[model samples]
Target: MSISSMFSNKTSRRGFIKFCSYIASALALPASLVPKIAAALERKPRLPVIWYSFQSCSGCTESLSRAHAPTLEDLIFNYLSLDFHDVLQAASGEAAEQACEQSMREHHGRYVLVVEGSIPLGAKGAYSVCNGLSSLEQLSKAAKGAAAIVAIGSCASFGGLARAAPDPTGARSVAELMQDGQIMKKPLVNLPGCPPLPVVISATLAHFIVFGKLPELDGENRPLAFYGNTIHARCSRLSFFLHGQFAESFDDEGARKGWCLFKLGCKGPSTHNACASCKWNGGVSFPIDSGHPCIGCSEPGFWDSKGFYQPIRGNVPLHS
Candidate 1:
């Protein structure tokens, strides 16, 4: 299909520049570099992204699909040549698998491989199989030819909740497998969360397209631009946190009054992400905004090891 088929007529150099201006200003970048950002956005080719599924609920796909102002149509059609995504593609069964194989072959050493779920490494890896091929085998083979691999959710990035508790299928993360140096040799970027913010995905794609490389990453390989500051750094309720006023229960007056949820097991103080600032569902709301505690889903071992509903002592000092 053509680019025009996916994006609105307004998707032009000026519109892209206006977008960069908004994003740069949001990230506190200098206005003088707006033209540079625009030029970078204009020149880069829309990357080919091959999205894979394993043992997952497809929440990451769902989250990213909600990108607004420029919806997934814009994302897949304008910014990315999403050659094969199991969830969004029209084909099914053999037809779908073959299409993915063909795209991988056609874009060999050129496409971005986005793994959305964890690989089940138990019972001969039989837990999740597609087209009679084990997910592990398919992933390993796909990784071998990808230019770069992005683990797009907590599942693929850190094994997520599926790997929690007994970990019945021995779920493992993309980084764990890649770290052993036996699979794909491409650089990896992890965007961990139950569902990462859409802008985080957009920014990563933009960085690759503009800079021709991944953004500066944290020790865990997450983009520093999005994950550098704690959620507490940008949370709207931080003022309440500083005053030591916290909600003691989900439906109590404190909560009703929009007091901080730190006392009710919010992990925002230690969680690093742009959830508060970028929000979700088209910048409408986030976990905290919706009256839910920040579960720290982006951090490692968040599912199984996250502490109980109580304020953590000796917590980092609240921002003024």
Candidate 2:
């Protein structure tokens, strides 16, 4: 994609500026930075992204694809040069392997390495393989020259379902691999979600492409701009929660009256994310909005939590 392609055609000069403003807000950047964002998008070439999946369900990639049309998410995705993706690429076997190798060689130390799933460390790394190489080998080889690493979904970021309980494959998150020296260290960011919100995913990627560096991250390496507040802090039912009106059951009267789902095991009070604001399916609704409790899919131990319907105590904070 050309430098100006993001603003060309139907994306008028005004629309372009509006987009910059939107991204600036989404990233929690100052209003004054909008101009810089606009300039950066116009001056920089399309960024290269190499997508590698391990033990995954491919829900993360599918989430990105669900971005509403004509939105910044769609445009940013369109602007990126997706060099390699197992699910999206047409080539397979040697052709696919060669293409990936060639892209790594050509864009060494510059391309973004986007990992989509958790790594299975057991069974000689046989849990997940592509192009005849195990996930570990592929990650080790690829990390040698990547400018940065972005792990999407709870699987890649925090081991999700793959690492729960028995952990049959010795599943581990990208951060864990880094901590254990199983992979090379690099500027890394984790977008943890069962499948992260589409806007959050796109905004983080756009921030990197625009600023030439990762955004301000929290302790978990999540973009603080998006994960800064607990879901309960910004939830629409917060008033209900504060008023002690909670739905004890999915079909209860409180539920019919749009009451809080805290009694129904909402983890919103402890989980931090932009789900309450950015929402899902283009900002229409999230799980709680549908009268269900928040399962806290974005948090590290969400999958292993006591139970999705088990109420978490009071509105205490677990994230700082």
Candidate 3:
């Protein structure tokens, strides 16, 4: 299923080029570069990837498995040389660990290390363990040889739920580890979400493979192309907000009529993510469109929020 495997077939070439074009559009690249991306992917060696998990629910990995725009098969079979993924790979126990170690040694300073959860420094990094090594120890070993690192969810990016107030695990993010000299600094990108949109992950990796570098990042280390706009600006309900129409309850007339959920504690106004545009469940609907208010899961410390149903701070009484 590699690009080389598809070279002899005409239909696959069309499909491959189409996949490349879709990826280009998703990454906000011009139509002109689709051929370049296709050519690069067709010839460039498959990039080595190691998907590691720590204090996570495995939701980010789950999200990527469901990626549709470029399709998970397109990414796995045609683009990346995935070396290690605990949940997906067939190897288990000691053998799996050895396989991961071998990939690190073999692809030293070349593999992309993708981490999905936060590192717990509590109890001397004993809160979360994998195999016989603590999360920190394993991360340090893998990170030393990584060309770049991708922190895949709110957990790895900002300590997430594990690092909520009165946290027992002393969970810390990848950035914090680098800052504290716990893990060596490498090119890093943080795609912060409860679980980042699947396309975002695929697009980021595609950008790296095409350009031979990471995408431009914001101050918070998110790719600006994906996280630049607040969900509110692109929300389908924006006109309702502007028109002063609000849904006070999930079952209210306004709600049924597609009015804005801002009054019902939608955090879309302040949240930065591609959900409003990119959507979920394969572009079907996001929370706001499904009669649920956003909980701002993409932002840091969201788990510590007082309540998902509580109104945002500095609320203006629209009809007071």
Candidate 4:
């Protein structure tokens, strides 16, 4: 089916305009660009996407699929052409591999590569394999012709849980793997979160689609618009933290009064992400808003960071 036709049956003109507006807003783009973004989507060819998995629990995929506002189906069917996603595609075995291969060949050096898990290099990458090939092999091959690559989660961006102490699997982030072998010279973007906010994923893709380039990236290759500020800076509890009004415990009176969670181990002060603003579950609430601490899941080596519930004071090592 043609790229534009795929949405013709499911999306009305108003819906498409709304989707474009949402994308623009999510990316923090100016309202003036909404019409341009809409026009681009209407005329652009489907951007083939190859999604690969390795050492992950599929949390990232779940986050995207569970998005309720505009719905994942709407994004996948209309905005991008998901050529191959092992967990989502009906095809399996040789059929699935063929689909990926065909997309790579047809769109050579022009398709987007989205990786969802850490790549294991230990034991010759025997720790993770698809079909008969190791994770390393799959990534190297797929990345060879990719136009751009996006490592879509903490696992894929950093070693994440798989690279914690002991490191049995010798898991490495996509960028590390790329550097090790000097493969995949294509531009790369990292979206690091335990399970990145669904809208962030959509907005990044939208930015690429509309601007024909990746958004400005921070030192970690994360989109600057989303990861630009410390969560504490934009947090609703910032005043509480500054005023020394902190919740000592989960059930303390201070906690009940909606005070800061800093004393209770909130990582907001050190974590850089849009959680305080973008939020989760369709802008409803984020971890901190729900009375939990920010776990710093978006930062590298977060799993090995002191402790999730341990306050970041003398013990926790600051990123900067």
Q: How many clashing pairs does model 2 include?
A: 0
Q: Which candidate achieves the best lDDT against the true structure? A: 3
Candidate 1 global TM-score: 0.91
Candidate 3 Cα outliers beyond 4 Å, as residue runs? 7-11, 315-320
In every candidate, how many clashes are there? 0, 0, 0, 0
Candidate 3 residue lDDT tens string, 1-320: 45767564333777888878877877778999998998888778878999999999999999999998667766777778888998889899889888888999999999999999999989998888877789999899899999999999999999999999998999999999999999999999999998999999999999999898988888889988788888888889988999989998888899999999988888887788889888998899998899898898888899888888888889543320
What TM-score does each of the candidates earn? 0.91, 0.95, 0.95, 0.94
Tens digit of per-residue lDDT, candidate 2, span 34-137 = 99987887777778889999989999989888865335344544557787888887898888888888989999999999999999999999988876889999
Candidates' lDDT values, in order? 0.82, 0.85, 0.88, 0.86
Candidate order, TM-score descending: 3, 2, 4, 1
User: Looking at model 3, which ten-residue stretch has the lowest summed lDDT?
Assistant: 2-11
- Provide the lDDT at 84 for model 3: 94
Instruction: State the lDDT at 253 in candidate 2.
Output: 89
lDDT of 1 at 41: 53
Model 4 scores what on Cα lDDT? 0.86
lDDT of 4 at 89: 94
List, residue by residue over 1-320, the lDDT tens digit for candidate 4: 34357456677677778878887777778999999997887778767899998999999999989765358887677667898999999999999899999999999988889999999889988999888999988989999998899999999999889999989999999889777764566799999999998987888887887788899999999998889888888899888877879999899999999999988878887888999988988789999899999999999999998889888876432222
Q: Rank the candidates by lDDT, best first.
A: 3, 4, 2, 1
